[model samples]
Target: MIGSEKLVARGLGRSYGDAAVVRHGRTVLTERLDRFLQFDARTGVLECEAGVTINALIDHFLPLGFFPSVVPGTKHVTLGGAIAADVHGKNHHVAGAFSRHVRSFRLLTASGAELECSRANNADLFWATIGGMGLTGIITDVRLTLSPVPSPYVSVRYERASNIDDALELFHADDHRYAFSVAWIDCLSRGGSLGRAVLMRGDFAPNELLTARQRHDGSRRSPTPRLSVPGSAPQFVLATPLMRAFNAGYYHSHPGAPRTKVLSYEPFFFPLDKIRNWNRLYGRRGFLQYQCVLPSVGGREGLIRILEMISSSGSASFLAVLKRFGEGEPGQLLSFPRVGYTLALDLPNRGPEVFELLERLDALVVRFGGRVYLAKDARMRPETFRAMYPEFRTWLAIKNEVDPDWRFSSDLAVRLRLMD
Candidate 1:
């Protein structure tokens, strides 16, 4: 804050896009600030530095029956990073986005003055920070409201949907009853099976419902240690034919499968966590994740167009997930949730051709009044961002009031004109 006039405060750099990178200026890496400040176990409220990761929190608190109220697919993200992105999870259809569970946090403004912000005090800053993508100010520490779980295991059920319509029907039917739900969509599928998906639904399991093995494993902890990928898998490994085959096997393996025996929270809620440096699998080229949420109206059409774009382009995505999102907090202007369906795609950086194909998908998202998630974006154009996120301008107005000099900036901010 003192030495650098321009700085981008970043946590674990888990954002798939340039949202966490400083384009030309220096970056104030916040990972070192990690420290567990305080905790109220009974109330499931805890205070910690912005740099404290979700994995760290789980390792320390899960045994006590408290966990993040809403978590994304991975646990490597930090508290500050989560707030910046306003991350959401499979349970978003019921619990809303992560910002709803954040109690308050300490904000370090451009002038290096600290302000305590929340719904009641400095409400603008609170809302701006929730989904403001860290452009408003620098987050230092946060007090989070956690959820109480019966145990560290989940009662899961799997069902395969024949097509996109069936998948939507299944999600709408069961979303109300389950705390968490998501589906793995087969992007490579074509013809009558376009948008075919494997649906997964689950909720925290009560201790009494845990299996003997799970109970013996103390609520089902991970047996294998997390390991980092040394490098990207050979490009040939993800060829369209191979991916199609993998998807076919996966879909056939779980068609109408009965309820699963108990699954641990780590594997269920954070499967990627088991592989420490999974990102490296994308290779030195770095991959991009395109996540977009389309409102219910025209959602099916928009999704179909997106898939069609990918299909015609022959750009195969190895991992794709689709889920429903509920309403979000008031102040979280940039929060990526609404009454709609959200889809996330993992694209390994094959080259310019792949990026060009994504641009077509972006056009389709914008046409349908859907917006791409800033957390996972890497190549979205500034014009497209403005058109998709109508709140972008409003958030910028608030950001200007705090960091008028553009002290807090990132490659994302620069690209999207968050600060000009």
Candidate 2:
């Protein structure tokens, strides 16, 4: 199908943008391709179809004391999407992106030829496809290395920071001791409270740390109570004042002193999963998730400027997160992570105003040597995209080599003129 027509392979449609949509072109859904092809229990290497989801991986393997080396905020994303985006997680400072653990994959090129790609075999194609956004080819199967853990629970420590500097200090002072680290920032806070956050850091819980019941529960898929937004919300649901209050309430709720607790992996990693259709909170127009990483050299100052802009703009973000990224994988040219601080903001889509605000944010990010996550972008200009990803030329060269006719394309690809 790919050889004869313009199309794009889609996994779970979890990407926030149109990376999976092809406009008038065909979309090949990989859901039916879901299957576990092979497994090496001793070494923890598992080969599975592209459609296999993080949720399935956890439900099946967590009981056996294994987990994907990296998982994004949600588990609904498929393995193919994870690789296409080179998704990172809370432990990025330690684990790097998902592509780092990928051993190899089978790619069906535009010519209908199946190529086995890895660091040592067809190496160029391997790195290209890692974060290539499915433009190079359709990924059929993947061999990945899973990390071993003592239990399914995570032992988490929470600390409150009065401002952005305090948060950075807390993270820099202790990031090496924890496997996972993230902070919930109050984007609406101003003055002395600007960038205030609650930092959560943790590692997999050891068996000795678990209670008798927890040991017996051991990776059992317990049913978590869920709530769903019944319908499209009113535009005022996320009004600036309401969001400001929510941010304040959340900030003051966390204890100022450090606190520790053992939590199931589900809540620790995917808190939003508990609220189904949470996006509905943003109303019928939806919301835009702008995520960017500033190089550590100027990251702190960049964050302050960015936060000040957001606060003054009055387009409050109901959900904001701050995290530190370690060095990036040299092989994945288009991958987003680097040694820096990344901030993600969930802003209500208020038409032109929101776009204008994002443009300003983009300029600041570029000035600070930062780049936005392609997986979450929907409205970035072509020139801005070029400015953020300097390796696009190299990635384009490989795309042209494997898919000269541009057989695989998406709304995102065309919007950014990726082929040009």
Candidate 3:
């Protein structure tokens, strides 16, 4: 691939979509540039190379009573990628996106100059780059404010919701009482059982809340995943029937009343991380993650419509998640989160039919004023993207000013017609 009008910088290869890839040209890979530059133990600010992984930061600082303010589902994402996507966490209703915690970063622009972008300096560039999907510039280093933690464990609560209405009501009733919240939805369930979910809310556990044996050490560590997927999955492994059974089993495993427990941070936040190469379970065709957020104004009805459509189409989603977003980060031009509820699902690639189903879902999302998360996107059309991200034009204006040559681009950018 060569002679493309734009280029892209990629790290860790974590984005489920083509945001980190440039099919028409070579892409910049930044994994080897990783380095920890500095840290302020007093204020919990960390300075690290853009290539540094989220897990690296957690490994080095979680024991020190500090952690990244916002962590996406995976710990494999790079600092630059996280900032580029303006990643959010389960606590999005509270702490906001990762860009909100970023103090400053060194950006190498297309003009062959290094600019220090921050909330107070080069403010436009900062916001544009945060969620611009690496089209603004190549981030070299970052200074981010890390959150202080009482311990590596979390005080968790599990509450089961029987349907869409019940889930929404539970979120409304408990969001203000928890620091972190998320719901695992059963998308295949139809009729009265449609949108059944298990809601989990958590807060960092303090020393006083720890057991006697666990309190022996001042610093506790997050647990490693117990199992790993060894080989490629058989073709029929995650088929419709299996996925339905799995979903049913998972839902039935929950208790009737809200149960509280002290669990390690790893299990509480990243259950998918429990297995290595878990994506392989969907077989060689792989899978696609469709994540969309509907506006709070009419989200309930819109979500129900989407769910009913999915159920009627007989498309099974093995992993479906639902969460509420509080608000958009200030000046985050292309960030995905807003005042709404987000639903994310993993659809196994079964052929042309999968795309057809997604296209229908896209239409509904547009009808209800929602947008798909670009970080997890793989096949959204140009017009669909424009409708979802209303700030595309505004982001483009700043992108042209900073990258007049359109130096930063990705496959996702090209497919969405973000390039000139």
Candidate 4:
């Protein structure tokens, strides 16, 4: 099918955009391809089919002291999706993006050929496929290096920042002391409180830090109850007033002084996963997740301007996050992370107004030498994409060489003219 039809591989559908949707073309689901092919318990090296999910990895290997080297906001994402996005996590400041740990993968090209791709073999294809948004080819399976954790718990410390500058200072001062760090900003706040946030930093809990009962039971956590949104909510459910109230309450809930606690990995990392179908809260119009990274040079001013726009526009986004990135993967051309600060927000799709706000944000990001994350982007313009990712042409060269006919395509690829 790949040889003759325009196609894009879909796995778990976690991406916020149409990267996996081919529009009039075929969509191949990799879910059933799920399988674990190999494992090295001692070295934490494991090879698995593209369909294996972060959730699956945790369930199967957490008990054995291994976890994926990196994870996004959710664990439902498949390995193939992670590689395609080169997803990063709270530890990106240290561990880097997913591509850094990938050893290799088997690619099924459009020419009806299977190629073994890695940093040392078929190296160009290897770099292209990582963060290539699956446009290069179908990733059959992956050899990944899993990280060994001391336990399933994280020793987390929370500190409150009065504003953006405070938050950035806290991050810079302590990021190196922890393996993971992230901040939850109140985008609705303004004036003296603009960008006020609760910064959370953590590292895997060592045995000595675990409670007696926790240590006795391998620090396992009891199953927490899950909640699901039954149906689409009204569009006004996320009104500015309600969002402001929620943000205020959340900001004040955490004490001003820093506090520490040992928490299960679930709450610390995948808090939203506990509420299934949480996107339903955004109503039938859904939401757009805008994630962009601003280089360190002017990131603070950029963030302030961006937040001011969001706050002034009344397009309140309660799920606003901030994180610092170390550097880009050396040879991974299309990967998103760079040495800078990244901000992400969940904006309710309010038709023209919201989109217009995004366009302004995009322009600001570009002015600050930043780029939007393609994995979460849905409405970026072709010219804007070109400006953000100057390396796209290089990636395109490799794509043309491997799939010269442009057999692999997607709605996003077409919209961004990636094939052209």
Candidate with the greatest lDDT versus the true structure:
4
Q: Cα miss at 345, model 4 (Å)?
A: 0.2
- Badly placed stretches (over 4 Å) of model 1 are 1-4, 219-228
Candidates 2 and 3 compared: the better one by TM-score is: 2
Model 2 regions lying over 4 Å from their true place: 1-3, 222-225
CA RMSD, predictions in order:
1.7, 1.3, 2.1, 1.5
Write one digit per residue (lDDT tens) for candidate 3, span 1-420: 234356789999899999999876668998876999999999988898999998888888988889789999999889999998888999999888888889999998888789999989999999899888998989999999999999888998999999999999999986978889999999999889999999999899988899977666546454577788877789777767777888999998988888999987887777788898899888888888999999999999999999998877667667889999988766888998888999999888888998999999999999999999999998999999999988988889999999877778788888888865
Using TM-score as the measure, name the better of candidate 1 and candidate 4. Answer: 4
TM-score of candidate 1 relative to the true fold: 0.95
Q: Residue-pair clashes per candidate, as listed?
A: 0, 0, 0, 0
Q: After superposition, how far is residue 392 of candidate 1 from its true place, in Å?
A: 1.5
Give candidate 3 regions above 4 Å deviation. Answer: 1-6, 216-226
TM-score for each model:
0.95, 0.98, 0.96, 0.97
lDDT value for candidate 4? 0.91
Give every collision pair in model 2: none
**Stretches of candidate 4 exceeding 4 Å from the true structure:** 1-3, 216-225
lDDT of each: 0.83, 0.90, 0.88, 0.91
* Model 4 per-residue lDDT tens digits across residues 139-239: 99999999999998899999999998999999998799999999999999999888999999999999889898777766354354469999999977788
